[model samples]
Target chain A: MRIVALAGGIGGARFLRGLLAVTPSSEITVIGNTGDDISLYGLRVCPDLDTVMYTLGGGINEEQGWGRQKESYVVKEELAAYGVEPQWFGLGDRDFATHIVRTQMIDAGYPLSAVTEALCARWEPGVRLIPMSDDRTETHVVISDEQGRRAVHFQEWWVRLRASVPAEQIILVGADEAKPAPGVLQAIADADVVILPPSNPVVSIGTILQIKGIREALEAKTVVGVSPIVGGAPVRGMADACLTAIGVDTTAQAVLELYGSPLMDGWLVAEEDAGTALDGVLVEARPLIMHDVESAGAIAQAALDLATEIAARRGTAPQGEDAR
Target chain B: MRIVALAGGIGGARFLRGLLAVTPSSEITVIGNTGDDISLYGLRVCPDLDTVMYTLGGGINEEQGWGRQKESYVVKEELAAYGVEPQWFGLGDRDFATHIVRTQMIDAGYPLSAVTEALCARWEPGVRLIPMSDDRTETHVVISDEQGRRAVHFQEWWVRLRASVPAEQIILVGADEAKPAPGVLQAIADADVVILPPSNPVVSIGTILQIKGIREALEAKTVVGVSPIVGGAPVRGMADACLTAIGVDTTAQAVLELYGSPLMDGWLVAEEDAGTALDGVLVEARPLIMHDVESAGAIAQAALDLATEIAARRGTAPQGEDAR
Candidate 1:
């Protein structure tokens, strides 16, 4: 099956690992969010794309859920010694190499999308990992801090203040003009199944959806999205703070409603939240916790199986993509 | 007093270490040769400058005589996994980070000299480390391989081939038109004493002299030279092959004659080659073997003292150049 996954970081990468484990290697395509990408020490660092790449390429720090394993800190120390400002984000030595090569390609007149492909050529992330856009699209969180209204880079919001303050708005800087990177829209259209892993709704899926034709492609696919908010709490990271910034309550129903029918066809929530009413959606409640790789594999299968069940019941399965 | 030293790689770095140990840190300036620099994976890597910086900053690998200590190679394996070519050069994970940042800066319109200064700001290599020029000036070696005539990059000639083949010619590509980097001429003009370390004559010191007006500035200064070859053998590396390529025999007198008259007010030779006659040169022979920091410190001080002695004897000594 040609399965295309829309992923963010950590949670998304972990779930993709499970999906890759369950499916054939050549069968998957990952549309990675570049919203969390940042220029650090003049390096273009795409955390979400790297997370997916490293996790799949066997270089990820399994314990930390970020950066490469057996990574060193010499670079950070050297940079720190140089008195560089904003030393919040941890760019481990091994991880820095990825950013360096990516930045070099980007500097060499290749767009981020092409740079992503070149980097993937090194990691081979198994499945193709396509950035949502070749164009520069940064996520800016507008917050009313002590210094008044201002938009901070996504990394500053995420890593610097740890997303402590409330945000008035979250804007994808260049999304309106950004075309979906090559293979992104086609992957969605040609896929037997399209999955939105339990990635951040606001920054991850939301960022990808902001790309010109991504939502349109999703509307045309047999799409299923797992709720990032389980039991009204994020599984990890500061997702809740971001959700709160947009005045959205952290809940399975809220998340499904947030994505709406334009993207999510069949919504999957935890079994604990079974019978939960999600308007205008076919909701399936399953054991959603990744648990372990095997359990995650089972959950992935369940999501795929649910898409099939939802598609069949709607009676528009093969006839039309709209009903499903 | 300000001091400018012409340097190459490991030997240059070791001598620089000694220079810093003997002289006041603020009074020293290093004109690092970029001939050994290479662009691996599109990142401009100035290996010699980094060596000098790392060595003086206490970040260098004292044992390996190059690169950062406590280095890792997770990135290279990742690069190889992706099928990157030129697998011979070992770009350690930590070292890769430096190249990445440098490439980023260079991409962002920062000339390498400024980038070197910026990098030095962090390492505080104590002395200013200026690239001989910001322009492209690569060293190429012409060798008669099985394929007949071929000119390879300096790194390929030095590291890949180990200079095992007979190098017929040593060419500094773009040296004819290359201008001295921003601080290079200034350092030379303001220098109290200039010392040529026992680095590779063709690839290191020879490359530095190729920069426009650098040699002219050296001729105006009270300069002391150290012969890289001792008892007709290179102190380290493939200096003999390089010497042979230029058709200069590996001897103290021949090496001194390569610098000729005005560029050398004095020359330091090893005790073994003390009796070797060098015309129009004030010569000092000493135990140049750097067995430890103390021994290296002695040799460095000897070079500076020789320069000072020559300056004192030269009718009128240059003021504002004492590195006390």
Candidate 2:
């Protein structure tokens, strides 16, 4: 099946790994979120893109679920010694190479989409990975503290602050001007099913949707979302904090309702959230806890099965497949 | 005594360390060569300036005579894994931090000289360190092989080729349009004596002289130079290859003659070249091998004594001191 997956960072990357186990990686096209993209020490860093790439390419640190395995922090230590700012972000030595190659390519007049393709040439990240947009679309979080009210970069708010302060607002700066990177609309248009991995709803997938034409394209597709929130709590990261910033409660049903029926054809929640109902959407309760690759693969398979069911109801089941 | 020293990379850095031991660092201003500066992976690498900084700041690898004391090559290895080009150049993880800070500062609109000062603030290298020019002045070397006669970056010739190929010509690509960095001319004009460290004459000190008005400034002052060549060979590095490229022989006398009486007020050669003579310039023969810090200090002291002698002869001896 031709599948398009929307991804954020660790959770999305892990889910994609599971997705690949159940489906042919060659048939997958991952539309990675670039809202979390940051430039550290003049090197462009796409944390979400790299996490997906490394996890699928067998270079990711399994324990951390982010960064490269056997990574060294000598570069970070030296950067600290020089007293460069934003010291809270952890950029390991092995991870620095990805950014260096990426920044070099971008500086050499290649757009980020082209650079991503070039880098993927080395990693061979199983599935095709494309950034949401080549243009800048930074996610800024507004907060009020002793430092007063101001919008900080998403990384500073998320990584540095650990999302401690309540976010007053989440702004998708430059999204209005952003054009979906080349092949993004085509990927969505050509896909048999569009999967939203257990990535952040408000910041990750939501930020990508903010880009012009992305949400419109998704609304026309059979979209199935795996809830990052299970039993009113995020499985990983600080998605609850982000959800709260948008005035959404930390519940699978609340998140599904946030995406709304127009966009989602099917919603997969955990068994704990069974009996949840949503208007104009196929709601299925399953075991959503991704404790291992096997469990994650089972969740991915369930989502695919739901997509097939939704497509069958619309008389648009995937080619060469019998609807169950 | 107030002093201004011209330097290149390893040799110059080591010489400055000895100079620091002999003279109060507060009295010395080092004008470092920027000819060897190159951008790798979009980050500016200032080899000569960093050498001077690290060596004096007690972070230099004394054994290798360059880079950090305890360097790691994780970044380089990772870059290689990404299949980035120019793998021949060794940029350790610790060294990458310096370039990152410098590149960031430069991108933020700070000139290279200003960035150098900012970096030095962290190193606290004692002596004021300044780049020879704020503008880009890359050294390109013309070489011939199967590729025919073509100019390559100085680093490609030095590090990749090991200067194994005979250089047909050496060019300072942007020297004509370059301006001496702020404080460089002022440091020379106000100095009691200017010392030329055992840096490569053709690419290091020579490239600095190519900057407009720098040579003229040195000619008007009591300038003393220690020969980088001893026993008809370079004390260290590939100074001979560079000297030969400019049609100068690898001998102390030949190098002194290349500088000529117009620029050299005094020249210090090795004891092996005791009979080296130059008209209208004081030529002193001393043990020029920098075996260790003490030997380096003694050589620095000898250069200072020769400068004082020349100043006394010209009735320009520094105030409050009789020539020894």
What fraction of the correct interface contacts does each predicted structure contain? 0.35, 0.98
Worst 10 residues of 1 chain B by lDDT: B315-324
Residue A49, candidate 2: C-alpha displacement in angstroms: 0.8
Best by DockQ: 2
Residue B162 lDDT (model 2): 96
Model 1: residues with Cα > 4 Å off, grouped in runs:
A20-26, A57-59, A108-126, A271-275, A278-280, A314-324, B19-26, B300-314, B317-324
List model 2 lDDT by residue over A1-324, tens digit each: 788999999999989988888875338899999998998888999999999999999899999999999988998998898888878999999999899899999999999999999888888878999999999889999999998999999999998899999999999999889999999999999988899999999999898889899999999999999999988899998999999999999999899989987999999999999877788799999889898888888899999999989888888786434223
Best by lDDT: 2
Q: Give the poorly placed runs of model 2, Cα more than 4 Å off.
A: A320-324, B320-324
Judge candidate 1 at residue A194 and give its lDDT. 88
Q: Per-residue alpha-carbon lDDT of model 1 for A1-324, expressed as tens digits?
A: 678899999999999888878765437889999877888777788999999989988888999898988887767865666666568899876776677677667767988878878887777778888998888889999988888899999889888888888877999998778888888888888887789999998999888888998888888788888878788788777788888878888888888888887567788888777776655567888878877778777777777877778778776453322212
lDDT per residue for candidate 2 within B155-174, as digits (tens), equals 99999999999999999999
What is model 1's C-alpha RMSD? 3.6
Summing lDDT over every window of 10 consecutive residues in candidate 2 chain A, give the lowest-scoring window: A315-324
Alpha-carbon interface RMSD of model 2? 0.7
